[model samples]
Target: MVQAALQYERQRRGLGGVFLDEIARIERHVSDAPGLYQLVEAPIRRATLRRFPFGLFYLEELDRIVVLACLDLRRDPQMIGVTVARR
Candidate 1:
């Protein structure tokens, strides 16, 4: 996520902050409504970031959400799935 922010920051000033703010907003949504998203894999659910091509993969447990990965949507679907599964 730092890498992404850096890349965005390089592209334009304050863009990285914008990206991070969007991430925080989506994270809060996930925290507020754990089951609001659909499952991406057997036990993993995905919450897509607004205005960006990234997605947050997580596992909804009995008491908390375990974040698996923050991945780029532009990558190969199989690769993203594998990355999230490994985490």
Candidate 2:
């Protein structure tokens, strides 16, 4: 099992609070069902919540999962990467 960590700035965004809630939900799911998460590439992977327009991006490390950012589908994913790196 992999431990999970959320970036600080990403936690602050809240994105009207829904983002944080969704992230927590994802973390719980990941904790219970790590195998269900799909790889997007090195340093990044995504998991979607049913009926939500958002996706969670995370880094799968050997000991833990680093949640880089939670993104709304309408936003630019590239920019989100830059933001996560900056944080």
Candidate 3:
């Protein structure tokens, strides 16, 4: 996520701020109630960014939520699965 924001910063003056705002929006949604998000797979839920082409993947546990990945939507889904599987 930081890498994408840095790239946006390099490309434009204030675009990175836009990304941050979207991230904050997503964060608020999660922090308010993690279980509010829709499930993506069997055990994972996904929260999408409002403006940017990114999504946050997470898993809710008994006591805490685990953030699995912050993915740039431009990447292939299969590649993303491979990347996430290793972790």
Tell me, by TM-score, which candidate is best. Answer: 1
Q: List model 2 lDDT by residue over 1-87, tens digit each.
A: 111223433545534355456667888887666557877655577788653566777777677777776666667867766765675
Please write out the lDDT profile of model 1 over residues 1-87, one tens digit for every residue: 999999999999999999999999989999999899878887899999989999999999999988888989999999998898777
| lDDT: worst 10-residue window of model 1 | 34-43
Query: Model 3, 9-73: lDDT tens per residue?
Result: 99998999889888878877887798888687758887888778888888888887788888987
Q: What is the C-alpha lDDT of each candidate?
A: 0.92, 0.64, 0.81
Error of 1 at 72 (Å): 0.5
- Give the Å shift of residue 71 in candidate 1: 0.5
**lDDT score, candidate 1:** 0.92
Better of 2 and 3 by TM-score: 3
Superposing all C-alpha atoms, what RMSD in Å does each candidate have to the true structure?
0.7, 7.6, 1.5
Alpha-carbon TM-score of each model against the true structure: 0.97, 0.57, 0.84
Q: What is the lDDT of candidate 3?
A: 0.81
* Candidate 1 positional error at 57, Å: 0.2
As a TM-score, model 2 comes out at 0.57
Considering TM-score, where higher is better, how would the candidates rank from best to worst? 1, 3, 2
Alpha carbon lDDT at 16, candidate 2: 38
Best by lDDT: 1
